[model samples]
Structures are given as structure tokens and as C-alpha cells.
Target: MDQETAKKLLVEGGTFVFLGVPQETQFGIDMQCWNTDEDFRGIKMIPPGLHYIHYSAVSKGTGDIAPRSGIMHYFQKKEFLVKMWDKDKDDMSREEVSEESIQRLKDNLYNLDRHLGPYPYEIWLKWKLLTSQITAELAAKLSPESGIIRASVELLSTSDKDRPRGVKSPEGSMDQESADDINTENSNEAGQSTAKRAKRATAQEREDAMLPDLKPAPGTALRFTEIPRDKYPPGSTPEEITKHYLDQSYTLELMIEQQEEPLHIIGELQFSYLCFLIGHSLDAFEHWKELVILLCSCDDAIHKYRSLFFHFIRTIEIQIEEMPEDFLADIVMNKNLVYKKLREFFRTAYMSKVDGRLLTMIERFKENLTEKLQWDFTGLDADEEDERPVVVRLDDDAE
Candidate 1:
């Protein structure tokens, strides 16, 4: 898909995944890994911070990706931004990755590939890793039934060279209002030095707030309810189990039908486990591999879930609390076995789809996934919730 389309998918479709919209909800999966001293072995320790992502999928042609024209915002990184897309219908091998395509990805990403002299391919790999991680975290949060992601995405319109050297927050002059309840400003030298004291949410911070509220519980995955004998017959065959499971949701039914739409129909089911996580209170990372297995094993009509497994992994990152960066790196590297199992699940699901609702169900599944992923992380830190963004009250709305 072209970059514009990808961006749209990342935005619109991605929003659905992130926001936790109603049915037609998207589906995604995640796995979290802890980065402790043992996992790192002799390496340096990870800094304390959150690191997770969400991953969601859509048909290649179903979304838009053109560069947008508006305030371009993103988390700043020292490395060159590279935009990778499938052009000329080639695999992602270095040989097939044309210079023009690479340039395009760079240009589309940062908009100034010419200025960036030259960097090793490993940099791109890091970008991919980061992207994969981000996507996976997002997907995991989105895939669950309670995946309440509450974030927004905007396109990067301006060229890198044309962009400002260091963009400032829009309301830099604003300060915390006093008890009198009116607007106030803290002007200092040239409105620059005081910038440090200004507190506006970071993109990551905002995203953190946007995460689904699993209060009383912690993560999005639903806790498994004991399957009564009525739900699944005693000694039911694996095939029967699969079929019975598929019969539960209309989303899954559509996927099995697999109409001629470009999109694939994957099965739809709310993560019962996520509800469990929210109600029972649990960490998102601990059950990473199991979630991955479930997602990778979805029996969609087209059977192309493999292409999007990593995307699912990236989505998972958002639901969990952030981790230290170095620790995240270790988990990514050492968790090779988990991926193998995930791949196997994908194979198994493809083999299991007998009726065909899997493809259509994919859309509904995504719809659901997005709901769990896009959550409002902002909680009443000290008191009850107030509907207005500007103020808080102990009781009664502030008129």
C-alpha cells in the first residue's frame, strides 16, 4: 500500500483500533515482556519508563496514506524517519527494496532524505522495530473487548526542511489557575526560559491517558469464564469446539462468508480475558504470548493473517504500562520462542476455518479491538470525574 493509504489506515482504521469503537471493531493482539536484570543478562539496565504498542490490520487497499496538510506532530527521535511501503509488488528484502522506494519512505516520513547524508541499514531496522513495537502495543490494547484507547492521529503535512527547528507547545504561556478561578499567565524572559515549567501533556502522556480505563482492573484482556457443558459439549471434538466458538458472534459469521470486498473477514470475539484483567486487576504483559496465540490463530476467510501478526504485536504495547527502553529491547530479542508459537497458531487457525465467516468477522473483530485499544487513560487522580476538560469539582457541574 502507498504511504498515504497506510497513514489513513494508521489513522482512521487505526483510530477504530485505538479508540474502541462499537462493533465493526477491529481485532489485534499483544504480548508484554519484562526487562529485568535477569532478562538483560550482562547488558545495561533499562531506564524506568513505559514501552508498549498496538497492532491492527486492514486490507492493503482499504485505507488512505497521503501526507496530510496540517500541524505535523510526532515523538521526536534522533534517527532518520523512514517510510516503508509495498511498491511494485515486491517482498521486503534488501534486494527488492529499491533506492527510490527507500528514498520515498524517508521523504514521506521525514521529508528531507537528501539532507540526511547516509546511515546504516541497521537504523532502518531500528525504525522497523520501533514501528513494529508501537503497532503491536496498539493492537493488543485494541483487540480486547474492554480495550478503551482514547487517542487521536493527524497526518504530517509539512516537509521536514520546511518544519520548524523546535516547535513549542501552543499554550506555553498558560499556567495553573488559582483558587479564584480565572485564567493566568507566568511570563518570564522572552517566553522561552519558562518553557520548562509549562506542563502540557506529551504525546506519549496523552496516549497514556487515552488508554482504556480498566480500573478495578488493570489491562484490557478479558478473564476467561468457565465454559459450561452447554456452551461446549463434554468431549466435544476440536472441530466442534472451533465451530461452536465461531457461532457466538455475527462478526465471526461475516468473516466466514468472505464476500468479494477487498478486506478479509476475521472472526469477532470480545476478549473475555481483558474484562477479567480490568475487573480482577492484572498486568498486561504477563499474558503476552497467550494473547498472541489467540490472534495469530484467528481463522479468517482469506488466511493471510501471517502478514499482520507483527502488527498485532505492536498494538499490544499500548494497553500495558510503559517499560524501560533497554528492557524492551531485551524482551524483543530474547522472546524468539513466543513468535514461533504465534506463527504456529496462525497456521492452525488457517487450517481450522471450515465455514468461512472468519474473513468478514475480521472487520468486526477489528472494530472490537480498536475499542479496547483506544482508551481514556486519564483517571480521577484525586477525586470524581468532571466532564469539562478545564476543571474539576467535588460535586455538581461548574456552570
Candidate 2:
């Protein structure tokens, strides 16, 4: 950046005032991360936009970093955001900062200037491309209620009503009454001894027991729109339903309706990708894959939403290229849903009528992937019986 532009940004860009952060804590904004030193404060001259602030607490004694946690904030021009770290919890403090403190910090900005790092200007264009579609409203709607996205979600035991049906409780000693019910006339002594053993178990032992059926702690899970399980609208004929299942156009329509705008679906796609790539959330990765599959499986949508598909092609091209090599290997080896879905999309596009421009872009995208990642898009429509998708239709008299 030129000096004038840099000076302009220094005046107009947002400021983040992070206080009480410990040394060696992993701190990051967007694509960059750093190990904090004693003099480190926060970021300055941040371009006003939706940015992800993520961190992982490092254990001082063991030097082990905890699971990553992040929050998304839309910074306005010249905005000043402040946060404090909680030493006890090894996380950001929930307590609010008073206005007076904020004003004081603003007044002392120059004295603290040296401690703050400038927003990484070099990566700005790439970051913009990755997050272009995400709006503030979209971010708020998809983010967890607690406003934090965690790589590892905290879990808590729930009441029976809250527990999902058909999921068995973790292995533990049975209650005395239940044990009594299990006792046969000849095994009364064994049942009594089992009950005694159960009684003798320590409270800490019970508390520490594995709970595979536990629920995610409230306000921590992402609020992604649920993809319809039925795939087809109600009252459709068996043939129509089967066609819907095979093409997934109706399913894509339903998903698009859930968003404020058709392109917000793409916004969510970018959001989920960034969440996974930067925030290290597997849940986000799962949502990203589902969105990709849904977008790729559409047939009629290819023509109707040519622009959406165009941006999608570019968006996913960058995402695939940015993916870690080991992770890309795993995707290629395990299921390879992305490859299969793209092939299905290409097959549908060739078999149907789509815009010439879109076709040209798709061809270029295919060639790029083939050249860069060595992905084969040849013979996409080949009739492989074993790999072919099966659609089941219920007869009218099935009931």
C-alpha cells in the first residue's frame, strides 16, 4: 500500500483492543495467526468488514494448545472493539467493558500504538474473495447463539426428554430396582451384590464416566438450516418424487428458500468454508460439504441460476486449491463426495440446456482442476452400474 493509502486506513479503519491476554496464547484474525509476546496488545487499521477472530489457549506448563474458539464480528469504519481474557477459564471474558474504559483507551491510543499489529494488507484481496458473499445478517443468523464457534463443543448430560430417542445411555451400573428386575429366583444373591457394587461407586467416578449420548452445551452449536430429508414435496407422484431424488432440484429450491436471498446460500457456503478452514470447526466442514453437494446436484437450477453457479464455481475452485494437501488426500480417498457431486453436476449440465458462457466457464474450471490437482473429469457420464445412484419408489398399496 502507498503511504497515503496506509495513512488513510490508519484514520478510517477499525481498531481491536484486546487486553489481559497471556503470553504464548495463539491469536489470529482471518488467515493469519501469531504467538503473543508480553508487549502484544491487539490489531489496528483493520478494514471494516466481517472478520473472524479466533484463538487457542496454550498451557503454560505443558505447552499444549487447546481447541480453537472464534467469534465473527462486522467492524464498521473507525470502530473500536474491546475484549478481555479470562485467565481462570482460558478464554475471553464475558464481562462487559464500561464506556469510560473504552473512552480512556481511545484517548490513550497513541501511547499503545507500538504494541498493535497492522491488519495484514497483503492478504486482503484473497480474504475479500473468500468472504465477499457473507453479509452481517447472514453471519448473525448462522453463528451460534453464544456468538462463539468452537472446534470442540462442550457437552452436558440432559434429561430423558432432551436425549434423542433410540440412543442408549453410556455403560454404567444399573439401579437397584432395575437390577432387582433382572434377578432370577436362583440369582438373587448375585443381583444384590451387583446393587451393592453400584451403591459403592464414587460420585466422582460416576461423574467422570463416558457419556456418548450427551448433548452439545446450549448456545454453542451452529444454527445451520436443516436440509429436508424427504427431498421431494408432499403430494408428489411416485415418479415425480423419484425424479426429485435423482436430480435434487426440488431439494435445492427448498434450501434456497431458507435463505434471505438465493446468493446468501453462497454466502453460507463461504461462511462454512472459512469456519472450517480458519476456525478449525469440523461441524462447519460438514455443513460446507452438504452445501456443495446440494448445489452440485441441481439440474434445473443450472439454467435458472447461472450467476449463482458461476460464482460457486469460482468460490469452490479457490476453496479446493486452499485446502491442505493431506486433507485433500483424505477427501479424494474417502468417499470423494466433492468429485462425485461435481461429476454429477457436469453430467446434468451436458445432458440439459445451459448458457454457453456457463458451459465455457465450467470447461475452464474442469481443466484447471485437472491440471492443478490432477483430478480426472473424463467420462463423467459413463454408465457404471456399481457407482450409479439408486432411487427407491414406494408403491401406492405399500401400506
Candidate 3:
């Protein structure tokens, strides 16, 4: 920025004071943090807008940090906020600094100015993709009291009294009676062991029985709603299944609520994408995959939410382009839900007469996938005899 603009921003910008954090801590605003540092305070001249500040305390020996905690804050111009590190409690909490002390710090601002770093203008474009929809209003409506976006894995809690056998006890403790009963009942009447029953719960079972409880738990940083999925009756024909899905998916358009437009779902997508891809959170990733699948599975969805679906495609394209190569490879090689959804989109677009814009966008996305990942989805067959997608490899540059 030019000197004049910098001066104006300095006059109008907010000052965040973080006091007493020891040397070499990992913390900062989104996508930017301290490294090789000592006596960290906080960022200054911050733009008056919605921003997320996160931090983690490093472990003593192993150097493994604790789960990161984050809070979303809106910095009004000239706002001064103070937070102190509770080394004993192991957290950053708001502190009530006396006006005299605050004035002293303000007067000696030159001493602290050396520690302040500029907002990362270079990566703002990319960062905005994940956070642009997060308005101050939305943040205030949903964030925890502290306004921090802490990402942590949540395991479903199961009641020991009702939990089925073969599942480990919640407390990792097994009663002697239960162990004896299991051993006695291990063999069937015909002498075959019932060990086959010990399989881990399936994805569908986990989703059906568990996920609902963990979401929106009192301190959950982001609100992720359950994604809709299509279920077909036993012995239903493919045609009937498709019709049912289309009918069900069409009804989702009515789900928009006050302060939430159709495209606001994109905000949820961005939230889940970050939670999954960057936070390494399975539940968030599950929501992301389901959302994509729900949109792509319905051929008519592209028609109903054309612009939303178009944006969805572009977002995924960017995700695929920017994600680590190894992670993308795992997503494709494992035929995960995301990979399957992309395949399903190609199949749906091929079989139906989708919107021209959507069709072109999907084609371009497919071309990018083919070029970058060697995923060649050239044609699809939804016929009764052969309903699988056809993969035809062409020259690397082929459209």
C-alpha cells in the first residue's frame, strides 16, 4: 500500500493486544502466524472487518501442540482489545487492562510496533474463497461466546448399557461378567465362533446413529447441518430411483430461510471444506462430500440451483487444483465419496440435457480433472444393461 493509504489505515485500524505468550509460539490470524519469534504481542492496523484469530500451546517435550482454538472477531476502526495468556490455565482469555496501563502501552507503541506484521494481502484472494461469506452478522449469530473457531474431532458417545457387543466400551473397561458371557457365547450351537459379528460399524450405521449428536455440541465452532441423501426402496428400479431422487431434491429449494439465500449454502460448503481439508476433520469432510453428492446426483439440481451448482463446480476445481497432490491422490485412488460424486456428476450431465452453462462448466471441470489427475470420464451409460461410466483416455491436451 502507498504511504498515504497506510497512514489512514493506521489511524483507523484496530489494535489487538496479546500479552505474556512465551517465545516460539504458533499463532496468528488465518493463514498467517508467528515463526522463529520471541515476546509476541499481537497484530495492529488490522482492517475493520470479520477475522479469525487462532492459537495453540506447544507441548513441553514432544513438541506436539494441543488442539488449536480460534475465535472470530470484528475489528471496528480504532478498537483496542486486550487478551492475556493464562499460563496456568493454558489458554488466552480476555483481560481487563487498566486505562493507565493501556495509555502507557499506547504512548510507547513504537516499542511494540516492531513485533506487528502486516495482513497478508498476497493470499487474501485465496483466503477470501473460504471466508468471504462469513459476515459479522453471521459470526455473531453462530459463534461460541468467545467467537473462536476451534477444530477438534468429536467421537459419538454411546451408552454402555445399550451399546451392542463387539463395540468397545466407552470407558475402555469391560466387566468381568460381560467378558465371561462373551467367552461362553462365543461358539454357536453348531460350534462356529461368532467372531464375524465383531466387525466395526459401517459408514451408514455411524452416520445414522452417531453424527446427529456431535454436531452443534455446545462449543462447536461452526454450524454444519446434515446433508440430504437419497435412499431407494428395495427392488426399486433405476428409473424409479432417479425419479424419486429428482422429486426429493427438487423440494430442497424451499428450504431457504430468513437471512439465508439459496447461495448461502455456499458458505456452508466453504466451512466444511476448510474443516475437512485443512483441519483434517472427518465429520466436516463428510458433510462436504454429502453436499457435493446431493447436488451432483440430481440431474435437475443443476437446473434449480444453476448458479449455486456452477459456483460449486468452480470451488471444487479450485480445491482440486490447490490441495496437496498426495491428498488429492488419496481422494481419487480410494474412490472416496468426493471422487464418486464427481463421477456421478459426469454421468448425470451426460445422460440428461442439463443447462448449457452447467454442462459447459462440468465439461471444463472434467477436462481439468483429466489434465491434472488423469481421470478420463469421456462418456457415460445409464442404460439398463450397462450403467457404468466409460473412461476413455485421450491425449493429455485433448478436450
Candidate 4:
């Protein structure tokens, strides 16, 4: 931004007043983060729009960091949003500050200005692109009731009846072979062997103990739209149902209907991506992948929602480019879900009657991915042999 623009934002932009944050706490707004010092107060010159504020409490002694927690706030022009840290809870306070206190702070704004950090303007454009479709209403609707998104959700124990029966042991638990080996190695003499067996028995007992069922703490779960289990429409023929499963246009439609508008699907897509990318929420990442798969599986929607698809292509292109290298490697190794889905989408576009403009945009997107990421988009129109359905022919004369 130019000096004039920066000066304008400094005067007109919203202010976030975070009070009583401890030193070394990870604090961020939008895409930027910093470890705070004693002098740190909050962020200023924040561009007024939808932004995610996230933080993780750092342990004083061990330097261990807790799972990240974030909140999405849509800042109005010149807004002054205030929040305080709770020392006892080691989290942001839920209690509201009194108006008198706010006024007193405002009265001493000049002195406090030195402690505030300006929002990083360089990332504003990219951040805006990432969240362009997300509106205030959509943010409110999808955000948790407590308005906080946590990487590791707080869980509450459930009743005995509600707990699952015969819960499977967690991954990396001791197997029977390992236990047998231990038992054999310890069987030197009767008394020592008996003591070892008893110890093993106690260990087994602890392992066998049923853990209580836990659910997310109230008002802390993201309200993403549930993907429909039934992929096909009601009363469809077997062949149509099979076709619906292949294309998933009906399922995508159902998901869109759950939102206020068709474009809100794109909005939710953007919202989920940001939640995962910034908030570091695995739940949000799952939802983001689900949305991506749903969007890429549609054929009819390509024509009906050309604009949405256009933005989606642009949105995901940036997202893929921005993905962490190691994470991208993992995605590429695991059947390359995004690549396969995009191939399917491209195939559908070629086979179906989609808008020429969309086709052009899709071609460009494919080319960009190929050039930058070295992703092969060759033979997209060809169906995989494994995916093709076998057909059986019956003779009419025999019937």
C-alpha cells in the first residue's frame, strides 16, 4: 500500500484491543502472527472486513504451546473491538468490559498507541481473495455459538448408556503377540513369574477399562452443513440412482439448498478453507475436503452455476498453491484426491454442455497447475478402467 492509503487505513481502519495477554503468546489477525512481549497491547489499522483472530497459549516453564483457538470477526469501519485475557483460564475472557473502562482506554489511546502493532498490509490482497465470498451473515451462521474455533475441541463425558460398547483400542496399543513375548521372557521362576503375570494382568485390566464417551463442549463446534448420506433423489430408478452416485449433482444440489443462496456454498467453501489454513482445525480441514469433493463431482451444476464454479476454480488454485509443501506432498501421495476430482470435473465439462467461458477458465487453471505444480492433466476425458461399469446383454429370443 502507498503512504496515502496506509495513512487512510490508519485513520479509518478498525482497531482490535486485546488486553492482558502474556509474553510469548502466539497472537495473529488474518494471515499474520507474532509472539507478544510485555509491551504488546493489540492490533491497529485493521482493514475493515471479515478476519480471523487466532492464538495459542504458551507454557511459561516448558515453552509448550496449547492447541490453537480462533474467532472470526467482521470488523466494521472504525470499529473498536475489545477483548481481555483470563489468567486463571489461560484463555480469552468471556466477560464484557464496562463502557466506562472502554471510554477511559479511549481517552488514553495516544499513550497506548505505542504498544499496538499495525496490521500487515502486504497480505491484505491475498487474504481478501481467500475470503472474498464470505459475508458477515455467512460467517455468523457457520461460526460456533461461542464464536470460537478450536483445533482441539474441549470434550465432555457422556452418560454410561450413551457410551459406546466394546470400544476399540487406540492405534499403537500393545498387541497380543507383544504381551505373549513379555509373559514368556518374564517366566524365569514360579514366584517371580507369578508376580510378572499379576503385573501383566493389572496392565491388561487398565487397558481393558472402558473410557467415557465424550462430545464437543457446547457452542464450540463449527456448524458446517452436513453432506447428505443419500446421494440420489427419491423414487429414482436403479440406473438413475447409479448415475446420480457417479455425478453427485443431486447431493451437491441438496447441500446448496441447505444454504441461504447458491453462492453461499462458495462462501462456505472459502470459510472452511480459512478455518483450516489459519485456525489449524482438523475438523475444518475435513469439511473443506468434503466441500471440494462435492464441488468437483457435479456435472449439471457446471452449467447452472458457472459463476460459482469460476470462483471455485480461482479459489482452489490459490489454495493449492498456498498449501504447505509437506502437506501438499501428503495430499499428492494419498491417491491425489484433489487432482483426481479436478480430472473428473474436467471430464464432465468436456462431456456435458457447459459454458464456453467456464471451459476456457478451466483450461487456464489446468495449465497453471501443470506449469507451477507439475501436475499432469493429460487424458482427463478418458475414464479409468476400474471405474467403468460392466454391462451384460440378454438375448430377446431366449426371453
lDDT of each: 0.32, 0.85, 0.67, 0.85
- Runs in model 2 deviating more than 4 A are 164-212, 389-399
Per-residue lDDT for 252-355 in model 4, tens only?
A: 88888887888888899889988888888888889999889999999877878788899998899889888888777776566467767887887887789566
Q: How do these models rank on TM-score, best leading?
A: 4, 2, 3, 1
Minimum summed lDDT over a 10-residue window in model 1 is located at 38-47
lDDT for each residue of candidate 3 in 1-399, tens digit (9 for 90 to 100): 767767876899888888887666677675676642675678877777766677778866778777776666778998877777889866776566788878888888899877766666555567766666656666665455545556673445555554565443334345566666668777658676653233345567656555333334455546665443325555879897777664445435533443377766666666667655555456666777767777666666667778888877877777677667887888778767677667777877777777587788888888888987897565455432234457887899877
Model 2: colliding residue pairs: none
List the lowest-lDDT window of 10 residues for candidate 3. Answer: 250-259
Question: Please, what's the RMSD in Å of model 2?
Answer: 8.5
lDDT of 2 by residue, 240-306 (tens): 9878977887888888888778888888999999999998889899999999999998888888888
lDDT against true structure, model 1? 0.32
Question: Per-residue alpha-carbon lDDT of model 1 for 185-273, expressed as tens digits?
Answer: 33444553323344465777557444443333233233332112243456979998766564332232333344232111110111222
Each prediction's total of clashing residue pairs, residues at least 3 apart in sequence or on different chains, is 112, 0, 5, 0
Please give me the total number of clashing residue pairs in predicted model 1.
112
TM-score of 2: 0.85
Q: What's each prediction's TM-score?
A: 0.22, 0.85, 0.70, 0.85
Residue pairs in clash, model 4? none
